[model samples]
Target: MQKKAGVGFYVFLVIFVFVIMFPFLWILLSSVKPLSELFGDQAFTWFTSNPTIQSYISVFTIRPFHLYLWNSLVVATVTTVYTVFVAAFAAYAIARLRFRGKAIILGVVLSVSMFPQIATISPIYIFLRNIGLTNSHLGLIIPYTTFALPLSIWLLVTFFRKIPFDLEESAKMDGASMMQTYFRIILPLAVPGIFTTAILVFIAAWNEFLFALVINTAEDYKTVPVGIGMFQGQYTIPWGEISAATVIVTIPLVIMVLLFQRRIVSGLTSGAVKE
Candidate 1:
């Protein structure tokens, strides 16, 4: 029975991986296919007789894809950094300190994160317009950070709670101030959690569509996701160019996940396992 179950699990895993990877594989293959072959009357197939780099070149030349890439990087990086830094303090307080309404506050934060961006877009748009922040990176960054904060705080708080309280008490005994202990002791120990939270925040900000679209309306400030969506050829959508753009944007994320898979796994599981 155990042998049969193990074989079943492997089969399931293989199917799951294929399902998850199929779209990405399609995008990747389509990106390299020539326009003639891509749009030919022949039924679409995985095989392409002629592949060209024209789609990739067009992605950059036809639109400000480079600028869009830069905007995504800047916005995602800044939002991740600021959100994680701020959430660190909030998470630390919730994890280590005894205070009134802490549970309520944490619950509210989680609840806020659960709200879809669609629900908040109208008010957010009005606020940005009123502040004259529309069409600017700062406009997008603010909302991105706001949305990312709850998850960041929740993850960090869970990780922080897992840390031994004895280290904190020892820091206090050694004449460290509260801030000093946080900076010197607790924060260092929570590096894994911080990194994991940062990556999640960065990815969220990177792929965010609605907030990026509504907040940054100008070509100069648009992110990759929005820019890619704009690949239209008057008559129809440019599938080849869109595929290329997707492949380009997806590569970075794949590389990041591969490079940090170990740390991400460790950080994610570390807090979940308690004695």
Candidate 2:
């Protein structure tokens, strides 16, 4: 009976993995196939007789794709760094210190995080325009950090709460100031959670389309998603090139997940189990 159950579990796992991976596999396959084959009547064909790197090459030549890639990296990196920095202090305060209206503050943070981005777009646009920040990296970076903060704070707070208070008290007794302990003890112990949250922030900022599109009208400041949208031809869409660009854009995220899968899982599940 145990053997049969194990076999059943393996079958289910295979199906689940395939379901999740099929779309990416399809996109990767499509990216390599020549346009002649992609647009041909051989619809739904998984493999091609001939594969070419033309689409990948064209993705860069046809547009400022390198600039788009760079923009995404910079914006996402800055947003993640700022969000983590700010959220750390906020989380440490909320989780480790006794403060007034802590519950209220946390509730507000969560509620604000839940607010729809679409609903706030116009007001943000107006504010950025008024401040003369339109079509700039800082313009997007500020808002991305703002939008990413709530969730970062929430995650860090949970991880912080899971840490033993005795360690902090011990540090305090050793003539270490709050900032010193935070830097030496808390940050070190919370690396998993911090890295996990950073990855989430980076991915969110990288893939963000609406704000990137609305905030930066120029081709120079566009991110990969928005840049890929401009790959359209006169009459038909450039599926091959679009797929290639998508594959390129998605590779970094895939690499991040692969590299940090264990850290992410550990961080997410850290506070769930208590001694």
Candidate 3:
């Protein structure tokens, strides 16, 4: 009976995996097809008549895809590092340090996350403009960190709070300073939470479109998503190249998340289960 249940579960999971992956599989296959062949309505299949790498090359030559890739990498990396760094300290403070109004402070930060990003755009635009960060990577990074930091803090703090205070007390009794204990011990134990927050923030900054479009005017400053949008000329959109670029851009992120899947899942479930 139990074996039958296990078999049923595997079957369901197989079906679900195919359902989730079919669209991406379709996209990857279509990306390699020649534009001419792709346009005509034909029964969709895994094969294309004239699969070529021309679309991929055109992305680099026609528009500076490499430069845009660099831009995105710089901004995403900076935002992730800054968000995690700030969130780590803030989370530690809230979770372990004796402080007044910790609940209220943390609650306010969480509440801020509930606010729609669109609501903050005007102020963010004006602020960045005044600082001459508009059309710059710093502009995107700053706002991305701000948007991601609150949530990172919440995730890390929640996870940290679940950890027993005994370790911290033991460290303190051994004459290790608070900062030393935090940096050496507490931070190591919270690896899963940090990775989890980094993944979330990385995805947000990597995929942010509206802010990227509004803030950056130069081709050099645009991210892959915004740069891909520009592939649509006054006359046409290069769906083949666009799809190829999409696939290319998505690969690194997918790989990173998969590599860290266990830690991310552990972090996400740790505090929620309280075990």
The digit string of per-residue lDDT tens for model 3 on 1-275 reads 44546788889999999999887888888888877766766526569876888888888888799998999889988998888898888898998898899999998887887888788889999999998999898989877765788878888887788778999889999999888998888988988678888887777888888889989978889998899877775566678878888898878877987898887776567546765
- Model 2 residue 14 lDDT score: 96
Best by TM-score: 2
The deviation in Å at residue 56 for candidate 3 is: 0.9
Tens-digit lDDT string for candidate 1 (1-275): 34546788889999999999999999899988888777766328887877789999998988789999999999999999998989999999999998999999998998998888898889989999999999988899888866889978988988898899999999899999999999899989999889988887788888899998888888899999888876678886888889999999888878989999987776567546755
lDDT agreement with native, every candidate: 0.87, 0.86, 0.83
Pairwise lDDT winner, candidates 1 and 3 = 1
What is the overall TM-score of model 1 with all chains considered together? 0.90
RMSD of each: 2.5, 2.4, 2.3
Give model 3's TM-score versus the native structure.
Answer: 0.90
User: Candidate 3: deviation at residue 207, Å?
Assistant: 1.6
Candidate 3 Cα misplacement greater than 4 A, ranges: 1-9, 43-45, 267-275
Top-lDDT candidate index: 1
The residue pairs that clash in candidate 2, if any, are none
Q: Which lDDT value does model 1 have at 217?
A: 82
What candidate 1 gets wrong by more than 4 Å, as runs, is 1-12, 262-275
